[model samples]
Target chain A: MSEFDLIRKHLTGIGARRDDVVVDLGDDCAVLRVPHGRELAVSIDTLVAGVHFLPDCDAESLGWKSLAVGLSDLAATGAEPAWATLALTLPAADEAWLAAFCRGFAELAAAQDVRLVGGDLTRGPLTISVQVHGFVPAGHALRRAGARPGDLVCVSGALGDAGLALRHLQRGEPLDDYLRRRLERPVPRVELGELLRGLASAAIDLSDGLVADLGHILAASGCAAWVELDRLPLADQVAGVVAGQAAGGADWGLPLASGDDYELCFTLPPEHAAELSVLAAAARCPITRIGEVVPGSGLRLLTSDGHPWAGTVAGYDHFHG
Target chain B: MSEFDLIRKHLTGIGARRDDVVVDLGDDCAVLRVPHGRELAVSIDTLVAGVHFLPDCDAESLGWKSLAVGLSDLAATGAEPAWATLALTLPAADEAWLAAFCRGFAELAAAQDVRLVGGDLTRGPLTISVQVHGFVPAGHALRRAGARPGDLVCVSGALGDAGLALRHLQRGEPLDDYLRRRLERPVPRVELGELLRGLASAAIDLSDGLVADLGHILAASGCAAWVELDRLPLADQVAGVVAGQAAGGADWGLPLASGDDYELCFTLPPEHAAELSVLAAAARCPITRIGEVVPGSGLRLLTSDGHPWAGTVAGYDHFHG
Candidate 1:
């Protein structure tokens, strides 16, 4: 019944041995030998018990989502994954819960080859704070400010599934495997990001939905976008979930406003679009052409027929939610 | 009450700009131009309310201590101060609380010259997780495994003040500003650590008392230590606080067992002892010789008269406490 016991049992020995890791989990600080000519990319994300997920959510899923959230940031910046640190706060050290959580976290860590260098454990309300670090060659990191007016907007995967899953779960609607998977274990597109290193002009991960996140890109890049509503790759079971609701069939706008997709939303020059398709096929990850960048500001939703479309499309806001 | 509003009002525009920071606070991930030929030192520490600190502790103090906790890790590794990301969790958004907290955090951040590159804000029981990143030359960072036999053990600054402050506060005794400052704003010895780069063989921060923290270095280094109890630098005013206690006056054991005194404990080759005095004077961080490394294992506390001293000196344990 101590922090040391909890960490030693569950966290230690999880890091894969690497010479670059001069000091590992048990040290006051972990020393990592950054590659000689690469820049470091860093991000932090925190998930609370009830606020970020259901209090009754599975520990394995929570563990997966925690690191995935931070890794998604690396994907947005086109950085190759390197290492991660996790700060876990809990109400109590239940052995089963700790084991399950570590199992889920270790799987992802091994797959990504991200060494678990150092972290902290504490007693408190359930919270997971993960900070991930990666590297990219100098002067080649993707940026939100790099989008040009003639770029084509692309998305890596289906949107609105996680958000739709949340709504369905809250409303007592049964969820299929795909819907639940999207909500519980959304994938981070790190490989796809690496492939887009020179191809993508700008990129961002879709955590706060398309409108809000894409709006961020527009604001940062100082340009506008025209997203064709028909082009959105909606989740398969999402339409069924909406059909069962009182709001009628296939809420087309839902895909644009939903969050937690963790998919990459990026822009590329039209000339590079062909190269992206080849890369996308090689990655075996779906890449849909959702929109195009244009002059001026603001995210504009357009109809399939090239006319302006007006519909409420806003993303989740953490404080408001 | 949106997340964007909360962050824009309290967190954005707060980054201390630097040439190495390619992307700062507003991006999905912060990009740093890692100095060529330098390795990265990383660490994470989380402070939970009612565990790491009193629930009603001053927000200003909490903010300063939050970052200090992580910076202390960097000091233990002899890494030069660089950048940090803060994950702040709270039950509610009170403007006054946020403002006071940021004030304390910003002052220390400016003094250390570490940029506030990125972070996360969430709703939960109050907790602060800070991840700090710094730089050291390849293979030059201090490690707990390097304490060889015949090394002189040293500590930076005084100990037991924070422990005394906590004891007084818990016991409902009259409090003084000095003790409270020691508890709230204990300075991390980053500059002194950089000064000890090639001199100190092993280093660790005193977060969990001299006995427990020093034991870690001993265990890792495969060497034993004999600490001269009389040499421990206790607070000037702590004697008065202990005198007022009913059990005893100036309990010498408090400094050995009491935690939260964020001072650096390190070991050096005996030859470098003279050099440390000059470095200590230049850094304005007092260095005290309290012990020596021996061939055997385990920490042996000694009386001033060269006799074996036996005393109960276990530190704070998260689960047991």
Candidate 2:
């Protein structure tokens, strides 16, 4: 069958609302009416083969990772996941590959209740470009510019597992099954974002390492942050990796600078920390208080002994080596 | 300078309003709070080098065309253009190319009052992906499914110049100055679409050829259409090309199926035709009634003598040869 036929037969069965979509698949353009009283939050992310993932990566993981990356944006801003459009470039329209991709994509999209509204399938080297849209009430969404000088910084879940997974894959080290799973499927904290709405003074997602990403919030809000390095909640698996490698000086480097965590990093006034703890307990997710925003210009890391610990900044840059 | 530096310097100049954009460009996500009572219209388009444009095509035109292609989607839904995010992939960060692209992008964006909100820059073969967001009053946006059997099919602006321009470049045919300009610069019918909002029963953008693109409306609305071949609005320069290539046949196949016109194709009741004509006159763009929806399936094209005209479908298809 042709690609168009394949799309109609297999991919279009994801149960998107036909009535809400003015134009669905198989059109020059897709027309959708935003429902009344909702503002649209939009984001786009492109994952290239060899750059974003390995050549031997499973199609299911790729589809899951593609949506997870885009959804992480919505999660960071406390926007409810709504619609997604995919632009797929492939070497050829291999039916098996397409089926696996659609299966994985549909599974994740269904879990988040995100509708697969429209997309483009083209001929080229393998690449997945996903644009996700979410809706938030006017003035109710979280932002990076709202943090004040005395706000406490917090992160959802443990950090460094994803970065360590990448390192393990690169070094040809045998990864424990847990670390491998974390790398293949990083969960986006969507529900936690919604719970943090009206609570987080400012927020961002950990796509680039925490320090670099938090530096964005600091720069935008014109405040500095002081992170207690010893207080960081590293994954047990990551700690095991560090212990196995026998690197004793500092294992926090990869977790702090390595990216692709897809977790929420946010801030709240110190007064709200108690309330936030209750909220985190209800959500069943661990919220780590990593630092506090201060009136200054750069991020400072504090050692357990109360001295400043200088570390190298090592986040992913597309154009930089 | 690297692409990241160029974005930090030039592209970031598109100001972000803290009130409107919850999370601005510097963060992992940009949050937009949708105002109450407004629906968000979203669309995405990707233009790849050697596929969407010639490798040596002017960088400025590439920028303009990329935005135009995406904005055309907004026009089809009768949405007011608001903001845009771009994903640019380059083989290398060339300073001159980046400057030209930013100039062209900013020029069109400023003219439309569309904010350059957020985007990603990456390393790869040159590709320009733009996802545009627009707003329309809740439930008031035009759609392709609303066309009734008796609705008149209308199109805004002239057709076939982009395709003819490509042919001229390919065959080394000397293009008149007007035709060259038309090919290089496509004027999207944004204003005309606004005028059509309450008038058009259903609408679509002419990116694919009229027959294929219009077929979308027919299929969705469960109606057939009969178009008069003589009524197609071909540019004067395109007429000259047709005259020169008389051996190609009387049907003017280039205008019939050559894509990239970016005109608005809409359907309206016969009673609204006069008001549409007035609106088109005020906008200084021609509105031509090329076809009428009928009670059946499939599209039929008739010559002045009312006979079927056989022309090949010359519009673009990614999977087809």
Candidate 2: clashing pairs of residues: A39-B34
DockQ score, prediction 2: 0.43
Cα displacement (angstroms), candidate 1, residue A136, comes to 0.9
On DockQ, the candidate that comes out on top is 1
Question: Model 1: per-residue lDDT, tens digit, A48-152?
Answer: 988889988999888888888988999999998888899998888788998888877877887888888887898889999999999998888888888889999
Candidate 2 residue-wise lDDT, A1-321, digit = tens: 654566677667553454556556544445565556555677788887777788778898888888999899888888888788887777777889888888888888888887777666766667778888787766677887788899999998888888888888888989887777678788888888888888898898998789878887888789999999878888887766544644545656667878888888999988888887787887678899989999987789888787897556656776774
* Candidate 2 docking classification: acceptable
DockQ per candidate, 2 decimals: 0.81, 0.43
- In model 1, what lDDT does residue B244 have? 53
Note the residue pairs that clash in candidate 1. Answer: none
Judge candidate 2 at residue B139 and give its lDDT: 66
